[model samples]
Every structure is written in structure tokens, then in C-alpha cells.
Target: MSADILNSLARRVGDGVAAVRPAAAMADSEATDPVEAVATALLGYVSEPGDGVLGRLVGALGASGMATALLEGRSGRDIAGQAVTGLGPADAPSGREVTAGLARWGPRLEEDAFARSIAQAARVGARLLLPGDGDWPEGLDDLGVHAPLSLWVRGRPSALAERPSLALVGARAATGYGEHVAVEAAAGLVDRGLAVVSGGAYGIDGTAHRAALAAAGTTVAFLAGGVDRFYPAGHEGLLGRIVETGAVVSELACGAAPTRWRFLQRNRLIAAASDATVVLEAGMRSGSLNTAGHAAALGRPLGAVPGPVTSPASAGCHRLLREFDAVCVTDAAQMAELVASVGGGVGGSGDGDDDAMTGAPPPRRLEMLSSAERRVLDALGTRRSRPIGDLVRDTGLTPGAVMGALGALDATGLAARSGEGWVRRPPDEASVRPGSWS
Candidate 1:
């Protein structure tokens, strides 16, 4: 369990794996570094996802170097010091943060436990995916320092990079409406040649996975626990099927149990691994919102299905729509549109401006404008300038509201002032510009 023992075991595992399967190393250029794989696997066993200190250390020193440093009993700050020596000053971890991180990870560095986990993973047909692996999802790079140290993947590792993916998440206690929407959305996404990603919990996540499978599409499940022990044992069959057709993935090593914090962390991988996130149905306090938040923070497009306003089960979706600038997507086509907009860096608002980027005429730009802005534009004549007071009277809005709306329009070149009043810009000039207003 000591550092020396861990180092020795790591070397043995690395050498054995390399010697036994030279083809594996040859097949995957990135996997040639068996020692880095050993270290990364061990790190997955000890550190939690989004460990900025570990991420920074690995980024600066490389996974092999950082693993060697940790195996050599280097303190967190010591590792940090070495990692930051030649790097430009940025937001890298400070000595204090590294010290604290070391304290946190120190107790979890049981070499015996990690070795056993690695063996268990191998027995279960899981492989360790490092940063440079060809199968690694490039979308995750957007996470920067918070990206996973390494991923434990079961099934086809290439599935992770097979196509652009979308995250379909919702309440575990999902209503039939939610499940139906999730299934359709997932299937439609697959038909469009994109992969579906989810946490693999019950309700919406499970439904999405099943639907994707039913449609014979690739779908990946990110687990909070280890891939060896699927959570919600009810979905064992589903997980197995996914292992056959897609992949079951995790940041934790085998034998690790799912925890509340790990579940939250797992949501980030779901968000980051996908091009967009869709919330079918969630309550006011649903965990799906956590995933949605991660998607928004990562600047990924987000979509939410609307439900009966009277249904409390739809409260979270409504909240996301109302407060989080989530696109109101009802059917698969709308969801596809959202995914299509993702390449434009459209983050979740789903305002439809991105359509213009694909050589399509931009939809009415006013649809995404604020009500006040829309009202002001409506009140102003295209060819005639109207004063603020006139706009307020015509729109039945306050003078301040009129001025604010005019200011927004002017900023976007949708409105221009003539003499002492404002006029609506030409339709051609007012057409939506991708990534401009959003």
C-alpha cells in the first residue's frame, strides 16, 4: 500500500501488459505508454473527477511524469512546483491548493487497492483510455483542467469518438411523457448519424439508451461508479447490451461505488462528452439540472422539452427554459436542429440563428429578441423614425423600457437613429447573425 509498493506493482503491470500484447501497443500508438496507463489507472482510483491540481500537474508534466512523481512520494505542492516551473502564469493551481489537494488524495493512495482494481478492470474486459488515445472523445478537451484523469471504458472504445454525441438526461422518476420524448429524441439523433450519451440511470437515461439501441445506434453510458459494477442493478441487461453495441464508461476504477458527489461529477462527463444536452423532464430539484448546468458552463447547446405547466414533474425543464436560456425543443426535428447548431458554438439557447451559418436564411431574428426589444422594433416603422416617447406610447411600454429596447437593437445594428428618433433596420440587415446576440 506504500508508494514503493505501488511503484513496483505499476512497473510490473505495465511491463506485463506490454509484453503480453505487443499488438495492443502497436494498434494504439497512444496506448504504447503502458506505464502512463498504469499511473492514470491508479490516479483514477485515488482522485475524483475534475481534480484541478491533478489535471494541472498532468497537463504540465504529462501523465507519466505526474504518476512517477506521485509514486515517488512527491507532495502535491512539490508536484505543482515542478509542473509550473516552465509554464506561463495563468490560473494554474497555487501551492496552497496543491497542498490541500495532496492532503485529500494522500489517504486514498492505496497501492494494493489500485492494483486490484486494475486487475478487476482487465478481468471485466475494460480498458484504460488516456488523453492521447484515438478513442478519447475530443469534446472533453473543452473541459480543460477539469477533464477526467483517465477513462475506464468497457465495450468499443472507438464508440466514444465515432460521431458527435448528444446528452439526453432527465428525472429518474420520469413521467411517461418524459420517457417518450427522450426515446424519440435519442432515436432521431441516431438516425441523424450522431451518438447518444447519458448517465445510464433509470427513467429517462435508461429509456434513451434503450431507444438508441432499438434504433441500432451507438449510445454511451457514463457511470458514477466503476464500469465493473453498474449502478441501478436493474439496468444490468441494458448495460450489457451497451457494452456490446457501444460502451459503458467511467472515470472511477473497478470496485468503486457510486456516491452522491461522484454522480454529480459523472454528470459533467455526460455533458462534456456530448455536443448538446437535452432535458426531457425534471423536477424543481432534479439532478438532471446539474447536468444541464455543466452543459451550459461548457457552452454546449442545451434543449428542454415542455410539459403540462400543471405537471410538477416538468418544473425543472420549465426552470431551465425560463431561467437558463435553454432552447424549447419539443420533437426530434427540433432536437436535430439544436445539434446542428452545436458546431456554431451555440450554447443551449437554441435561438435558431445558427441555421444561417449553414446557408439557410436565418429565421425571424425577432423571435430571439427580448420582448421589450421586439415591441420597440414593432413600434418603429421601417422607413420612418419614431421618437422614444412615440415608441413607448405605441408599444404601451414605459419610456425606460423603450429606451432599453432601442439600445439593445442599436447595439446589434437592428435599429438606427435618424435625426432625433429611431427606425427599424432593414430586414436584410436585421437578419440573425450566428453567435452575435446569443
Candidate 2:
């Protein structure tokens, strides 16, 4: 990557952040340093969010120090050598680990990609937030090395820091019962003068966000990909409305696309950014459980809104109440009290429940399925048949893994062969109305 090009783009983005949220509007923090912005932006471009090797390097060496090392084409072994001194042996990534990370990050280091990313953010009027920026949320710092290198924000940058935030997340295939609860809860929380945070997906997340907006309350949407491109294209209008008042935030560079792993990684941010997390409705395998897992891991208060025990969609919430000691919350008042009334939560992400909200173990009903099988099931179509290749591509699974997952799914009656492809079979309960969850 050309440092000159990176620096130029960073300067442009810096100016754009200033234009959108002037210095007067910034919190009483030091002025954003152009040099640090360039370095942070470079790290964002070279590595995916939550990259452990790069995260530790940046933590030890600072963004500029790490970026300079990578820009100079220093070998990962050499870079690891430098990081070990600062991080100490206990925390530093090994040479092999750093080299592997390099392999994952190296191909995306093109200057043109960086330029496009900068242009996209500018086009979207996003402000850049470095670690010490006044508007940068302190809660994110809890993640240590896993915290975001920088954040891209659209809408009022101050919205992130304006008030305490609560994360309300659940399944994209949310039940009407779930939506009703989410709307009521979100509206109540906002009315009580708290900011709401949720991934901007369909179903429960969208319901909570819309309810908060209708209440004329502050809310934040944490995205898995670039804030510039709203995933689940159907939510573009909702996301746009969010940017009209509350902020839309992302750690990934502007050109990055959402993926399964990234979606899982993104859950950590939503959990970290909020004071508490509430699961409105989730199935045994709902991604919202993953978010609850993150919240539990951070010792943030966790709550689960109960649905009928008969409803499979509520199984994860019940699991939380029964297994993880997540506070049983029915209304907004109870949800808010989860943060105020409770101290912390224990245990999360047991087996494999991954993103839409994101962690817990697979429900007992599907406990036999491996994580790979779960991923394949996530990528499969409910009615439409998909060939093994499509599943492989969508889930980022190797062909062999996809085949194995398909085999497991078939035996479990969760999927079936159809015209040389596969379709999800309806379980004992009704199949959910499909939408983007991960």
C-alpha cells in the first residue's frame, strides 16, 4: 500500500468529518490528529475488524507504528518480533500467528481500494472517530485489543455519546409477538430518555429501531459491514431514516461486505457499545443469542423477553433465563432495570449460536449439529433449492465442509435433496418467514 495515497485519502476523510460535525460540535477532546487518522485508516484497510494479530500489534505499537511497519513491507516474523517486546510474551501473537494474519490481510492492501473506501465514506457524509475522539464511546474500550481501531459514523456523531445506550436485538425472522414486544420495549426505553442500539437488520432489530424513531428518541444501529452499504438491501430506507437523527456505526472500512464471520465479530461491538442487551425474541439458534453471549462475556447485564414456551422462536430467550441467568424482562421498565438493577451476567456462546444478534450453544434440539452444519443451515433456502456450491459460497465453507454439513442437515430432517440441490425442511414447528439474520 502507498502511504502517500493512504495519507491523502485520510486527509480527505478527516476534512469530511470536520465538515459534517464541526470542531465546536466535537466533545471537549483534543483535535483529531491527521497523522493518527491516516494510520488508523491504513490499519482498517489492511485488516478486518477484530483481527487478533493486527489488534495486538496496534495496541502495542499504536496505529501509526503498526501501519508504518506494514507499509514498509516488514515480514510478519519481524513485526511479531517488535510486538512481543511491547506486548510481552503472554499477550503477543506468535510469529506463525502474525504470518497467517498477514496472509489474510495482504491481498486487500491496494491503494485504489483505500481511495474507493475514503470516497464512499465522504459520499455518505460519515465522520471518522479515532480512539480518543470525544464522541468515541468509552464502552468499546472494554474489548481491549478487540476494540475497533476507528469507527465510521453517519448522522449526529454526538448521538453515540449523548446518553446511556441499550442494545435490543433478536431474530430477523421475528414473530409478530416478538415485534409487538420489541416495539413496546424500544419505545418505552426511548421515552425514558435512553439511546437504543441494535443491528439494522429486518425483523426484531428493525422493529426496535422503528419504534425508537417513532418515539423521537436517540438510537444507534451497529452494522456488520461498511456503513456506506446497508446489508439486507430492504432496510436501506430504515437505515437512511436512522442517519437522519441517530447515528449508524461500523468498524469495517467503507468497501467491506458483511459475511458470517464478520457478523459474529460485529456482535461484540453492539454489546460493548451498550450498557445492557435485551433479547426480544430468538429461536434456539437465533443470532440474538450470540449478542447475548457477548453481553454476558462483557459482564453487561442481559435480559430476555419471554414468548410462549410452545414457540420455538423463544427457545433461546428461555435458554438464557434458564441456563445463562439472563434477567427475565417483559417490558421496557424491566429491560432498563437489567442495567440498573443487575450487576453482571455469567456464561455465554456455549456451543455455536452465531450472528443476527449473535452467542450461545446450539439448542438441545439441534445439539448434534456441528458449527459447520449450523452455518450451512443458516445459508440454506427455506423453499428455494440451492446447490452445494451456493451454500459453500454463501457460508464461506469449503466444498468438503459444505457436503458434510449437508449430510448432517439431511439426516436431521432440517434439509433435504431437491433436484440436485437442497431446501430447508420445515421442523415440527412452522418455518419462519425468511429474511436476513446473519
How many clashing residue pairs appear in each of the predictions shown? 2, 9
User: What TM-score does prediction 1 earn?
Assistant: 0.74
Residue by residue across 166-210, what tens digits does model 1's lDDT show?
A: 888988888888887887787777777778899899889999999
- Candidate 2 matches the true fold with a TM-score of 0.79
lDDT of each: 0.73, 0.77
Query: Once superposed on the true structure, which residue ranges of model 2 sit more than 4 Å away at CA?
Result: 1-27, 342-436
Query: Can you write out model 2's per-residue Cα lDDT over 1-438, one digit (the tens) per residue?
Result: 546744665665565444534566455656456666767876886775666667788888888777777666778889898888998988888887777666555556666667677777888888778777788898889887777888888888888886567999999888889999988888888766678999988899999999999989888999988888887799999999999999999898787778655677788898898889999999877778878888988888899988998999998889999999888888877776776655323122121111222335322324455667866887787889999766754554556667888997788788999997999876544433322344
TM-score for each model: 0.74, 0.79
Could you say which candidate leads in lDDT? Answer: 2
